[model samples]
Target: MKTELRVAAYAVCVRDGEILLARWVDREGRKRWTLPGGGMDHGEEPVATVVREVEEETGYVTEPTVLLGIDSIRRNWLRRLAGPGDWQGLRILYEARIVGGTLRNETGGSTDLAAWHPLDSVTSLDRVELVDIGVQLWRDRPPLGRSRLTDPANG
Candidate 1:
C-alpha cells in the first residue's frame, strides 16, 4: 500500500462561552465545522502554521498561548486518484487568543465560513472530531496533552 503522512496545526479559540470555528469543505463536498487551522507549509513551524492558517480561515489574528495537545491517527483508504493507501495524520492543537482582525469568511480556500458558536451547542453541530479533542484539551488540560474522554470512533 502507498503511504502518506500529513502534519497540521489547529487553534481552539474560546472566549465568553463561544468558540471560533471554520466550516471546512471536505473532498466529498460536505461541510463540517472545524478549528481555524490547516496543513503546514514546507519549512514552516507548527506555531507559524497555526497563526497563518487561523488568519486565512477566520480572518482573526491570533497568538497560540498554550500548547493544548497533539492528536495522531492512521487510516487506510482507497483514494480516487491515488489508489489505496495508508495515511497518517499528526494534528497539533493550540489554545489561541484573538489579538486582532475582524471576523470574516475565507475566500478561495478550503473553508467557506467562519463563525463563533456557543460552547454548549458545539456538540450538536456537524463538526469534525478535532473539535472535540481541542475542546477537551482546553477543559481538562492533561499533562500529556491528550484527551482521554474523546470518542475512539471519532478518531
Candidate 2:
C-alpha cells in the first residue's frame, strides 16, 4: 500500500450572470467541467498557482480576492505503479475575478475548452464537485479559517 497527497488551488470566477468553467476530458474521453486551476507546483504559493493555472486553462489573467475554503477528499485506488493505495486531495478554493485577457480554449492542456455558463444552467451540466463547492463559496464567504465537524459516533 502507498499514500499520495495532492494539494491544488482552484479559482471561482463569476461575472455578469455567468460563471467561468473549463472542460476536462478524461483518458476515456469523458468530459466534465471543472474550475480553472490545478495542482500547485513545489514551492509555489496557492495564490500564484491559481493565477497561472487560470491563465493557462482559460486564457485569462485573474486576481484571487479571497480564499473561500478548503475541500479535501480521500479515496483508495489501484495504481499500476503503486498498486492499491490511498490518496488524499486538498483543494484550496478561492474567489477570483478576471483582470485581463480574452477568452480562448486551452491548447495541449488538461482542459480543451473554456466557456461561461449561466448560473441557472450550471445544474444541468456535467460538472465535478468543485463546481458546486466553488459556487457555494462564492455565495457565502465562510470564516477565514479551517472548519471542523463533529462526528456523533465519536461521542
lDDT string for model 1 (23-87, tens) is: 99998999999999999999999999999999999999999999999999889999799899999
Cand. 2 Cα-lDDT: 0.88
- Error (Å) of candidate 2 at residue 14 is 0.5
Task: Name the TM-score of candidate 2.
Answer: 0.91
Report the lDDT of model 1 for residue 68: 90
Q: Please list the residue runs of candidate 1 whose C-alpha ends up more than 4 Å from where it truly belongs after superposition.
A: 150-155
Q: Pick the candidate with the highest lDDT.
A: 1
Off by over 4 Å in 2: 144-155
Worst 10 residues of 1 by lDDT: 146-155
TM-score of each: 0.94, 0.91
TM-score, prediction 1? 0.94
Q: lDDT of each structure?
A: 0.95, 0.88
Residue range 1-155, candidate 2, lDDT tens digits: 89999999999999898999999988888999999999999999999999999999999999999888898888999978779999999999888999999899999988999999999999999998788878877786668423232113334
